[model samples]
Target: MYSMRMFLLFCVLCLMSSTGYSQLPGPPGPKGDPVNDGQHGAAGQLGPAGSPGRPRIPGLSGPAGPPGSAIFCGRGVSGQELETLKNSLAKLELVVNYDFVRRVGQKYFVSYKKRESFSRAVEFCSQRGLELALPQNEEENNILSQFFGDVYKTAWINVNTNKAEGNFEADMKNRPLTFTKWGEGQPDKSIQYTGCTMLSENAFWRVTQECFLNAYIICQM
Candidate 1:
């Protein structure tokens, strides 16, 4: 019986030792190799476009610009200079159109070959910035007579009685005549219709009722 009990106690002791040894933690295993980074993934698809922004407001206007230069065609020309140019051009045109026949003092006389009525003669001279020939004195009359010579038998003068019977006046300015060389029986007050005057034979002034009588005209400037 004693041997059997001692054998039993030894068996119990061996079992407890085995259990304690199994329960003890063992030394850590060798450290694992560090993990390598994963390869990069492919890029994703692009997203949808965003909506448009609001419209912008307009700004205020700028100030006015500077004045223009007076220089024209590479030359400085003012308003007066332009007027002078126009006058020169008009004089040039007159020279081209009219025949310069005679000149007395500062006045120049020009004539047209075609005959016209007294009214038409006045208009013609007026359009050219001139007036119908009016003899202010005997000297001007003689000059005009010599100018007429044999070229024109009769010519319209600037004297007329259109305002009063036998009361001759300068047609242009309606002023009284300072000089008169009336032919005999001319400007007869009895002949009330004879209003306009003309230059006839010997440079004498004569009145006629025929205002439409076509006669040569002399223009003075």
Candidate 2:
């Protein structure tokens, strides 16, 4: 009976120690062996393309594309290119085509045998980087007039005298007429709004028609 009482006392003491008082944490255990790294997972399939985002401050515009090689009126084509043009026209079966090019002094002329309206002729020559021929002086005027021979009684030249009765200017050079070959009392202002000049069969020039009349074209380059 005494032993049993002693055992009871000892149990009570242990329960007090566990429940009534806080115990300190035990020392850390030695680290265990490291585990091998897991295998890398396969790359997931690319996510579906994201929806297009609204442009924020529009992305900088790309540089402008280079201009097309088509020739325009500003700067004349190089000699080599002109020669190439001449050759190409020569091979073409076009009647009185660009092959009928003539070089007088420093200027180049292309006379088309086919007659066209003043505006149409300008467009034709302009598309090819040429401008309607202009007579610089009496000499140029006579030469241009004679170039066409008697084929057409009249041919178109780049003479626009609209604003002023006698104020005429060349299309290509944009210069006033220092020398004119008006055939006695020419430029009959009573008829047309915009004067269209023509090289007469007599090798004289006169503003005889409106812009609509079809006449031989002579372009200068």
Candidate 3:
């Protein structure tokens, strides 16, 4: 992981104890006639610099401020608000999908179906009271689509990756996957073992081994 450093912060504060700045009692009435015997201007000695501006009291350090909501990268959100949400999710005992300090929107997401392949991911979500992430807009799509990039084989989405057989068991036998977003001309329909799946951490669907292959699963509330 990489870390970034920011410049030091210099905060100027109002010096509470600093001496007040005032002009020497106005030039004795009217300079000319020596009106009131202009009390011989006591050899005006320059006053000492106002005690270094009261040592720049660092703006009174108030009580530790509460955290803000958490936003992941690219989500575009305020830090304080994001920290608040992160804290709330932390309290609820839900796993934090990603970093909380980023300036991105981080609506909590989960990966409950761990160690399970696409098929099992469906079952995991069903029994666990969660669903796969279903991004609605380009923001969501972009966020969900560009994860781990090409580095991973493929990732799963909220979309169901099953080959619906139309609830049919024709001829007292099983049927092939009627509908699926399989890789073009793929799934080798001739093989009964293939199942619809996705490239790890991705949007498109492909065919891998049977549904029993264990992999990571991502779920959203």
Local distance difference test values of all predictions, in order: 0.78, 0.71, 0.48
Per-residue lDDT of model 3, residues 16-35, tens digit only = 22445433475557556545
Off by over 4 Å in 1: 1-89, 149-151, 161-166
Query: Which structure is stronger by lDDT: 1 or 3?
Result: 1
What candidate 2 gets wrong by more than 4 Å, as runs, is 1-97, 149-151, 169-174
* Candidate 2 lDDT over residue span 76-138, tens digit each: 687688788786565343324564666667766777566888888878878766678877776
Regions more than 4 Å wrong, model 3: 1-92, 95-107, 126-128, 136-138, 149-151, 158-162, 165-194, 199-202
Task: Evaluate residue 139 in candidate 3 and report its C-alpha lDDT on the 0 to 100 scale.
Answer: 54
Model 3 / residue 200 / CA error / Å: 4.5
| Predictions: Cα RMSD each | 15.3, 15.9, 33.1
Q: Write the per-residue lDDT of candidate 1 for residues 122-188, one digit (tens) a residue.
A: 9998888888888888888888776554666788888765645236755557777888888998665
- Quick one: best lDDT, which candidate? 1
Best by TM-score: 1
Clashing pairs in 2: none
